[model samples]
Target chain A: MRLTSWGNLSLDDYQTFFYDFNPNLLAKIPKPVIAVGASRSYGDVGLNHLGSNLLTTNLNRFINLDGNLVTAQAGINFAELEKVLNLHKLSLPVRPGTSYLTLGGAVANDIHGKNHHLQGSFGCHIKSMRIWRSDSGVIEISTQREPDLFFATIGGIGLTGLIIDVTFEATEFLGNQIKVENLVFSNLSEFNQINQSSQNYETSVSWVNISGKKNGNGIYSRGNTVPEFAKKITKAPISYPKNLKLNFINSTSIKIFNNLYQNLQKSIKISLVPAGKYYFPLDGVNNWNQVYGAKGFYQYQSVVPEKNAYEVTEEMLNLMKEEKTYSFLTVLKSFGDKSSGGLLSFPMAGLTFAIDLQNQGEATLKLMNQFDQIIQRAGGRVYLAKDARMSREFFESSYPNYEKFNSLRDPYFSSDLSRRLLGF
Target chain B: MSKILVIGSTSGIANEAIKIWLEQGNHIHLYARNHDKLKMQVADLEIRFPGHKIDAFTFEANNLSKTLDQISLDNFDIALITVGELKYSDELVGQIQVSEKLINSNIQIPLAFAQTILEKYKTQGYGKLGIIGSVAGDRGRGKNYLYGASKAFWETYLEGARQEIWKNKNISLSLIKPGPTNTAMVQGRELGNLRLAKPEAVAKVIVNGMERGKSVIYAPKIFQLIMFIFKIMPIKIFNRLSF
Candidate 1:
């Protein structure tokens, strides 16, 4: 079983409907809500909201592919999109964790990627899109057609409207290779400085010791698209094993692995790898989530404005350290855009870090809440797509344009997301 | 705007009751544990019945103290209670500690709201207290005696409360005795000669009894006759036969 909560009523009903019209589907037979997303999200934002959910998987059809101009459905997964574009030597400027989300979902999240400084979010790459307005009918929107819906859809959390299909801008890549570099930062201050200085520089990311709130800053990875000459496929980095949860691998083993990981990251110069390999390391194992075990893991991703980046980073680390809650991957990156179509997004021209940890009870919730408060005050926010838990008040406060987003959403449709998020 | 409150509104029975209220163009206030579950339901229900006014409030029917503190007794015109404990763990039964947990979650806790709500209804001069009880409360049997006993107490309580207020308060209390209808509680066993009633069906009877001002009703009607025949049988013979 994929245990994939697609936020749909029946895997069977969803499977059959290629399409079905419920006279009052949203208002009537709402199923248990579990949000469904690209699974790239850290939390239940995309997990099913209830018994029945709207499936975006099929929204991936390529409606029009004219030369470099391609219009595709929002439900199309990125992986398949990449395969098609790869055949034609084309690339989307906005690429997130993995190619497993609908184009609509991408825009709904207003996803930011490695080259956000240069290109901005996935929304910026979107030239135009067609939305199924709840109040209105289907309308084409862009900077021109229907600006409100267009902007709202860019980061609107699917609340604004249904992203049927979007026209995305593309860039060309020579070979499918991951160009990378590595650097090590000493502490929290150094990491913050590195992130700010690197803006408009490279698609750089860093890993830190989130376990130690006291001295939380640890490792950094500065990377960029290697020049065609430097793009060489060598060997894949030793991928982590599947079906293994190192969440609590004896303190001794954790200490040992931590030491090795820190050391390995510390002594790094520059290396060339496969493009797909660098973009998606975990894509190798089909059911890699199983590594977190049956209980699953919570991915805590938040964005802090440029000014409060350091404090946010410091506080997050200190809380995790104090709680002694360990994480497998604590990654730090930068986001450029201010908003997306979804009512709530995690970007605001700041440093965004995603901490992946095995769900370990109150410790995680407390730490995440502590971090949430900090980010909220700093005028930062969490990505709804990657969120499983958040207060309605907090969510409303986080997104400045929440009211606008709500107006766009079809009040009649009952998505599990709408159910859970709305406190139904 | 008939403000209706449906307690225990997150389950299947609650959903059906909510739908009926919506279909009838009445105002509704849903109550549930997890707010998210109720959120979507309200939205969907609103869609189902476009003009119905609806809202949701949270309450744990078993926690009388909290329910009293949180729930506004006058916020609704009608109070519907589906608050009852139907399940008992073998371990708890064996340990004999279930008496408190089950009773609190089911009996005394819900009964606590009677005076609170009835007082409000009496003051207002007109209101209905529709409760979903069970025929199992008619008499205690061997298998689920604890559950049956709790309902029996509730049934008897309603019967007494009905007389105490009788002529003065347009406040009506209808006891809905829904006899064995196949539900998640009764998973597989077929009730031969006794058609298993659907929750929708049970909910309808409860609604009918409340609307018709009938003090008590056995859902499916046949169950009442069967129970009457059983009730009139000699004690020795009744004890000798299997249910």
Candidate 2:
């Protein structure tokens, strides 16, 4: 079977096995396998390329929910979990950008969202998790018991073992409404100023118009869950046409889109929107990546230290313009001083910039390699969940805990990213 | 608030339908083969739909009769039988144990449960019964004749049962034939451009059809036309083609 991650970058054939929520079935899967849930990671982190890829979507079963804590299988995505939690007037402590992410995926990636400045990454909220390791069989790990392996497994990129289930704490659910305020920032420094002043907001992120002359000029939005309940609105996601042969996103179209988007937010706009609309706008369109065409697209997300953030991001944006690689979607956010617990977690106290570039084959790869050099120099690291082409040297240098995580990785578990970087 | 009985409740489509029914405030009694899995599912549902009445029982094919005797079926407003299995073999003579298991699981167990429930429905004077048949039952191909034969039996049984219960006026029986769906039963198979329907989508159609008192339903509705073409194909041409 052919398998790929959300980025649609590397569609390679794999020996796919579906998890049936049976422990015995795990023993039968061939060695060097990785358990993938939702395949929401926008890179080869979930792909094994000709090796075994254990599809864990079928393991999606909620085990229990007591008080403010909920336990569920690894394959239960946030969308399903949120529905159940909403019924109980509860919500997840850290809500990622998209609700389609499975609990295991969120932990493996240690994903951060608009609220990272306050709640930290997803791993911070995990109480405990059970993993099935080929070397030692199934075992439970938590902060107290096997603390090293527990942190290793979080943001461990599914290389530690196949996560079986996780118990996580839920946050208070005020309502489904979000009071969103959108402000315009003219430059990276201005964006940083606004981001610093908006610390009171629970969630803050910026959509940067990288194609424009003023680098990082775009709308900066801040949101907080409101007490007022919003009327439930269910919109069916529109899927991108599979047969479309050409990529419609180019320099000209991107400019038009940026202009149109800018026009919509020319004035400071304040509106009450649904939490889903505010948090997961991209999820409204299924397979939106297909619009990049058969060649797919690459997402380059990097977090730079706060001191070097402005200068480094300016240089990176200038480099993208120099290379004539106009990113269709560019996002910027700030992280607080909070550890993600996971050794390999991406977030740190810094400013993070993410952009999507069409897979221009060698050109995109070369440009990303250059971006890595600047990020590495600024003591920044590319997000593994969204990286498909980071160098082994860069990975080893960027993540100080790489060796520690490598020591704890399950010998029988491997992924395209691990095999490429760790040389397993 | 309706009392719904779902046999083989852990199956993908059945489980999804159970969720929908639970959301609609229906009290569900679930029965499955694996005790642990059944218990886990029931627990999951109990937490998801707090305050909803949910009861579960586990029984193997050989012990279904004994299990059925222990439980009462007098109050169920709806009963859905979603018990079936698919096993493929290339050999001319498949293993006897496999054949026996298929027959017992797909035919005997479901038939026994249906008969018991139908009797209770008849005595109680009103009920809706739904059995998940398959489009394969319309016309068996060389690929899945064993499974097809079992569902074909259901098509015949339900047709007769619908006529037999026609005078009851309040009683209804529906045979649901769903096309290839994205269930565990057909998850990893290579279908060559064939689109498998989502279990949730199929469940919605099944529950709607059962509520509307449809005697026969082809979920996705497209399956009705496809099955019609297969059901009337010339024998020679059909034999010459392979699916």
Candidate 3:
């Protein structure tokens, strides 16, 4: 079967095997097996070129849901988890941008969301996990027991082992709606000022227009949980549509869409929205990535320290303008001083900018390489979850702790990302 | 609330049917081969519908009779069977082995198990039993005779059983003949011109047919007409047509 990342880049042919919650099946599988859950990663991190992928979607099941802690098989996506949690009036401490990702996928990537400044990445909420190592038998790893392996498995990108079940803490919420307030920012400087002032809000994010016309113009939004006394909120029906055919997106159409979006932001300055609508806007459109066309697109995200964030972001935006290249979606968010624990985790105290540009083949690759150079000089690293073409030299330079993470990886567990970056 | 028993509970179509039944506040007893997966599914249902009662048992489809003997059929309102596999081979010897496995899984186990439930339901004078049949059974093909033969056997057996069960007016049976459905069992195989139905879509037809007391119905409704023409085609002309 053919497998591709969310970015629709790096297509690789691979055979997949399914396990029905049986651990012994691991021994029968070929060596160098990579476990795939949802394949939500935007790059080759989830694709194994040398061996088959063990699909964990069938292994989804809840082990337990006691009080605030929910223990479930790694195959269950947050959408299902959230459905159950809503009945108990609880929510995941750190919800990813999309709930389509399986629990194991979220852990492997140590995903972060709009509330990263307050809640940290997904790995922080993970209390323990049961892993099936290729050589070693099934064993439980947690912050206390086998801490090093547990830490490595969390953002280790499935290089550690197959995560069977995970136990994590859930936060209690009043309702599943957010009262949002949108503010328009003329430049990156004003966006930073608003972000600093809105420290009390539970969620904060901005969408910037990198095109030459709009330049730094964007919408900055902050939201908090809707209070109980507020008028009853209606949840929009959740639907997943089939991916649209190619040729759905082009540069001209995107420019018009961005302009319309900017204009709409001015009208909808304040409104109440469902949590799903606010947290996972992309989930509503299902296969929305196909809009980028058959060649797909690349999402380049990097986090630079607070001191150099402004200069680095300005230089990157200026480069895009100079090249007359524009990104369809430009997200700018701030990270807190939370420790992700995983050695290769991407979040840190800094300003992170994630931009999605349609793939123009070699030109797109060349532009990403140039962006990597700027990020490297700023002492920052690209997010592994969103990277499709980061160089090995830059990967090593960005993640200096690669040696430590590599030392703990399962001998037989590897991915295309590891093969390209670590020569595994 | 209806008391439903679903065999091969983890199969694609069965799972979807189970979800709809559970959503309607029915109490379900599930039986499948994978113990842990069934437990997870049961837990998921219990969480989603806390008011309804849900239980699960793990049993190999080939040995379903033995497992059914252990569980009492008393108080069950309906039983749905969705257990079978596709097997193929060009060599006669290999084909025989595949045929035997298919017969054991698709015909013997389901018939024996359903007979046991029907015997009990007949005495009680009120109950429903649904057996999943296949359109492939309408005619044997050079490509998948092994699988088609087993389904043909099951459909024939149900046709005979329906006559006896109808003697007791309150007892009901449904022979659900679903067309080519997109499922893991059919993965990689060329489905030819047959419209591939989604599992959920097929499940809806099965449940709705059971509610309407449909004895022998082709799922998707359109397949009924298609199969009507297919069944009338003379053997000489049918054998010449290739999927």
Best by lDDT: 2
Alpha-carbon lDDT, every model: 0.64, 0.86, 0.81
lDDT string, candidate 3, B46-79, tens digits: 7666667788888876455567676554668899
Which stretches in model 2 have alpha-carbon errors above 4 Å?
Answer: B65-73, B90-94, B186-195, B234-243
Q: Candidate 2 lDDT, tens digit per residue, B44-124?
A: 888888899898888877767676875453577999999888776553255888887888888999999899888888889
- What digit string (tens of lDDT, one per residue) describes model 2 on residues A180-247? 99999898888888988999899998998877777769999998888988778887878888668678
| Cα error of candidate 3 at position A295, Å | 1.0
For residues A331-411, what per-residue lDDT tens digits would candidate 1 score against the true structure?
888776544443455577878878776665676677778878888888777777667666677777777676766665555
Q: Every model's DockQ, to 2 decimals?
A: 0.01, 0.39, 0.27
Q: Predicted chain A of model 2: TM-score relative to the true chain A?
A: 0.98
Which candidate number would show the highest DockQ if scored against the true structure? 2
What's model 2's lDDT at B8?
A: 95
Which CAPRI quality tier does the interface of model 1 achieve? Answer: incorrect
TM-score of model 1 vs. true structure: 0.56
TM-score of chain B of each: 0.85, 0.94, 0.90
Show where candidate 1 strays beyond 4 Å.
A1-39, A48-51, A211-214, A227-253, A337-343, A414-417, A420-424, B1-243
